[model samples]
Target: MVVLRMTKKLPWLLVFMFGTVTASEFRSPSVAEKGPLRYVFDADKPGSDSSLTMWTAYTSKSANKAFINHGTSVSELTKLFFNESEFRLARAFPNCLVEQAGELYSPLLRTTKFKTRAKYTECSCIMGARWSCPVFEDKGRFVIRATVPLRRVEIERTDQSGVRGGAELQDVLTVQPVAKPSTDTGVTAKQSVAIRADFAEALQQSNHKNPALDFTGKIKVGGHEICTFGSEDTADQNQTDATKCLAVVGVDEGLIPHVPSVTSNVAVVSDKKASGSSYSAVPAAGGGGSGLSYFSDTSGTYANLAEDASKTVADRKTDQDTKARMWLIPFRGNDATQIEGVDTGGTMDNLRILSEQVTENPREWLADRGYKFETTSDVGLGDIDIDVGYEHLLNEKMKAEGYIGVRAPTGRGDEYWSNPYQVRRGNGQHWEARFGGTFAWQPFTWLTAKGDMYYSFALEHTEKRCAAFTGADIKNMGPQVDANVDWQYLVVRLDCNLFHPETQSLSSVFGYELLWKRKDNITFSVANMQTWLGKKYNSTTNAFATDEYALDADVAEKYTNSVGHKVRFETSLRATDYCEMFIGGSYTFAGKNLPREQDIHAGINLTY
Candidate 1:
């Protein structure tokens, strides 16, 4: 799992995020000093046209009820919203018939009636009938309606009337406004609010208010207050400007990297059992000087191997960051500054066989026993890279971003790494500059596509390395291997995003990338640490050169290429509007000596 703060750390500020959005202004409401508006119903009002009155029953029932004998008591003044009260209520109370003497009645009216099991309570023993009446205006007081009492109740005990009756009641109430004799009330004219606030003042206040529903701070009486206020245009403009900044910069480290310094520049040779003592002879038969020592290699096998692995790791990390930046551009829309990241640390691990026979024939005892010093290596390498970029929305259909960054010299330039198995780790101590462009298109609500192209140019680091041995001993060394080294990198990735499950900002991506690199003036001989003597000061080369080795630069070319594909699934969490988290995992398949890998990453980002 990879976790990162959305914001970069500043020299004086230790913040995990730098973005901020002004939610709302805490303004105190001013005491009203003006009169309020007067509103009166007009003929154009909705209900004033017909004023039809309808009586409908609301019902509530249990899914299943216990059965009771006939003539069970039922309560009046009960109702239900819908017939389907947990059970198949529709089947129980089918559509009602509405007609007037063979003439179809108005569909808007509930001009029908029916009786069903008890509702308003879960008790099964009780039952009641629903009575409904339509309010169709026939322009007369006479109406066609059911005779059933509007409210009736059956009780366990009978009243003096002795008709098995309990109670029959119908109640109604009316409200009358107070008369306007001189004044309706004593305090109607004091401390009144002015509904007709100046439009300019309202607009100015809305710029500071969180105008989500009330875009205008002024109160309006247009039959109803407009919750989707008319001042939204100005409020939106202000919100947009609030997030605009002159520049945005980021410095990052690790995708929560777990890579260890598995490989060091130091090499250890032991003289244990099965040692190459048979072949390990003293210079001139103990003619003094048979000690072992280590020399630096900027183009040696282990260094190059570890360096290549590190490059692969760094490349993948950069790709992840590119995708992250590209994905966020749409989320941020046009309210963004320079979206950039300067992240460091990546992981590199490789395995190399350490067989004695692979480089040199061991001693007679070791050869007879078929014994050799062999071990597999697990090495780690890392580096830091920076990107400062800007993105622009070309149109609603497309967006583009460009960046120029540097791969800083963050790695141990020399052979400075932890050697776990006498293996090498630190790549060349070098730095490079990168230029890249990203393009994205959203063709549909569920699909998005992205493309990226990048090029890197590295500054060469020249250092002498142990070369091909001219003999088996520490003497009789060959000419110095005056090797030169340089490198350049080119890569491109194509990514497509697929819709995620109900999550609003979630997606899955499928991508393919091709990486090409050129390492000029670099090649190594078939010399192992055990087979070669140590390095000595070479006056001819004016650099450190081995006493018994010469490097070969003609066996290889300066260019190498690799291709890889990745499938990643990422999703946005339902977090606060200002804070968002994205997490994903990808599986990579590569070719041409490149290792396959799996990566899990997540990061939190904030937009002001």
Candidate 2:
């Protein structure tokens, strides 16, 4: 598994109100608040844009899951297979005994309603063969069928010796039930019982060939094939219709050359330091504001402006403004001067506003300005991604793999954060379907290159979001309104490595990664907003009523599509047969609507 993270050490203030509400006057808090009539500050800046790259880098780390041609890990030596709970053995011939043992679980198996092996146990075979028998009692045979529940059973052909007939079998088999299995003889849905090795032979012959063989069969869903299943003839050692056994998606044994079985477990940890500066969108040249600034100020005075433009009595305004503002007294300007009708005292840093309300500064009240997350460090698990697939070694110099995965929204999403600046540990808690491929090449003894490309299709979900009045709720102290959001992401990465001759286990790896995210489409009901605003102001339901809701096209347009490119360098040391350590740093050199940030990370890889 791969993990990513970021920090939220805010350095700027954003207390502006949304839309047209005038509470109090103060300087703009961010460039997003630079112009008049633009009240809703892009509060999602810190948690969005370029900062999102950290989560995507997990795809780069997934390269480790690719299949290598050479045998190196324990998964290549020992394989694990599960049984189809309803598989059976009928017509017990005299000689054979089958034994299944292992403790393994697969998400695919769970989805198929197939029983998974939970422990190692030697159970009796239908043939009355002795338990733990090293030898057979009689020279007879039995055909395995899927008509009965053998539950959590898998057959490992301990002997590579071809059955006493003209056929061979792969080492591992997933016995799945067949419809109307024949009890009279070696027949399952009319499939011949004689062990067939065509699939296995092709798998073995394709080892050193170019354009590696394709032995996987299609797995269809809703009339579309979305994944593949191994075709290693598992029905009583006879080739079962691959399309029929969707639960047996993987036949780990014999998939990769010289690897007896395939199973891998990995753990990763990444650290991202808080950044004081971030790249931000600036008004285009000649399009308005000054040239772009690589950094944006996140702190400053904020104003809550409210207006009832059409409300008047004999051309005189009669609207009461209830917008409360937070004054940053310590950060006042140096040019302190007294106003004509208002008494301003002391230096600017120690100044005070003498209004009838005379409320204390934001610092005095624990949450007077706006709500903020606790500054203390928070640690927790991130979203969980389960990937399953197959890889084929094309030749001595290259290999390729295809896979599909699902991301579980188990981590904290935007709604869980106290403010927009706080880091959201998950991708909005939206289930995602991810598919990708990895290709690798090793042309020389000291050089290797690998590339990975993947796309994530985020499902739309309904969640609560900040619906502040005006833009005053910049600190996220607004009403929570249900919003439906949809997201999609695309990523590609390439890595080149140079190995040391003296220490083949050490290598210098350089990589470039790219990510593109489609702008999110967030939709909310205008009626919901009208109800909230009508209840609060009592007479402005008409003002809040509109065809385009506050968070509709306008707010969505502000974020646009985002793109980022990052380059990194790292040194990897294979310290032991089962362990490797790496340390690296990355710099995102260019992109739009992305944070131009740098990060350093270190982690270990353990294989068994």
Candidate 3:
């Protein structure tokens, strides 16, 4: 929602006065000191022409375009002044609803009625910007009177030079309080509170037999009233056999808040499970045979037999059954962040197949099959690639996960080719399978330590061009480890990446990161990170070189190093319930051999 506040141009103040005075008292010579001429009316005095005078008039021209100036004219004066007497009359009486030539001109009366003389002693004056007027008051009366400045007419004028001028005529309007009808005050007898309960067995038995309506009338004990409200139904579960009942107990006015009554009903069912089976059993692994041999025999025979036999017989007998059931209860406050309930039937079969094959070819296997995957790629490939990973958890603490992902070229190249090469696309498909576990140790209430480990194997297959350049099928096996310690408002974390490169020869590379967080009324975090380090045997040069040994290593080595220290700081101010302002900066300090670069970023964050 957006809120726009109108600008105020004038500082108008109000003073209120209350007194008993007749019409003649207002017209007396001594009262003239209040300024301007005064007029009063008792029941709309006959033949009275209370037309006001002694006021300066100015013409205003209004522009028809422009939203801010839509209602007022440009020629209108920025400020207006009303004499004390004129202001008083405008404040004390209802605005005149004058009609001329069948045209109605009312001073925008705010309310429908005017107050009696005895109650009309207080008055207030208001002055403000267009549409938003200010209110000034005389505080002597029991009730207050508010006056508004109203626009009467709009005009537009174009000068000789073709410049446009607009104006509007405004008048002061008065508002008064009116009386309303009194409410009826009829006494009511006191009622009583009722209580009832149905045990589990009773509820079960009621399902077998229909019970009729049962109620307990109001009863009083020791000046306290009680009423029991209930009902019971006995019939077949059908529209014709259904029953609905309700009861209400009226209580005395004084006891209304203290005593309350209740009504309830019970329904009986002729057929316990009228809708048929309430529970169903789905075999996690569906095939004709049983035991692990069923899958082993099929897989082995398929691989050994002819291609036709494998496709016709082995494929037909493979278990590919996947089904899910959801149970809904009409209750609030259920944990929906993750799926709950145990896999009570048995250990699902072919889980490893899902972890391997599905993760390996996710797009072809799970695409359009209701599974979601996400991934990040190419920290080293000079592009960003994201893939969805199929994930599931086991035993609450252990997580089984896998993903089938593809990384294509980005930018101008992305539009024409899938990968880096123009002649041959660099479309790389990668499959990752990993198992992770979390452990927590709480030595004290204010301090705790936690750790996690993930060991994964990634099989990456790129197009022929990429295979020729990389000299391998592009498969990598890696283990990731992360641990953290928290002491109330302070937290420290460590993460490491260790992987064996997937190339012609086995090579190892490792990266590490450390982060620290401190929290008070606000939050702050700092992190130091580095990555991609390894020693490689340069066959062409017949010498040992680091992973940074590119063909243009000499140029890069002149001013910058391959490895650098990345430092980042993030800070946020907790402004309110739903908003926060955060600022963060990162600097990359090149190794003793490289040039330096830094980056800065900040933005507001809102949570609903």
Tell me each candidate's TM-score.
Answer: 0.33, 0.40, 0.16
Error of 2 at 130 (Å): 36
Per-residue alpha-carbon lDDT of model 2 for 1-608, expressed as tens digits? 12122222011001111111110000000110001100011111122221110100111110101111222221110111111111111000001000001011111111011111111111110100000101122211111101000111111222123312111122211122223223686433411111111121111111121111111223122222222212322111111222211111111112211110111110000011113311111111111132211112122111111111232321111111110000111110111121011111121111111111113322122133243323222224334444454444555667665777666665443364223223333556788888888777878768878787789887998866655322111212233567687878887878787788775578887878777778767666443342111211112342222221233333322333556666867776768644556666665566654434344545554322
Candidate 3 C-alpha lDDT tens digits along 577-599: 34444444333322221112233
Worst 10 residues of 1 by lDDT: 24-33
Off by over 4 Å in 2: 1-354, 358-377, 413-418, 468-477, 525-553
RMSD of 1: 47.7
Query: lDDT of model 1 at residue 133?
Result: 17
lDDT of 3: 0.19
**Model 1 bad stretches (over 4 Å):** 1-382, 413-427, 463-483, 500-503, 523-550, 555-561, 565-569, 606-608
Top candidate by TM-score: 2
**Pairwise TM-score winner, candidates 1 and 3:** 1
Off by over 4 Å in 3: 1-458, 463-564, 590-597
Better of 2 and 3 by lDDT: 2
Residue 417 local lDDT, model 3: 18
TM-score of 1: 0.33
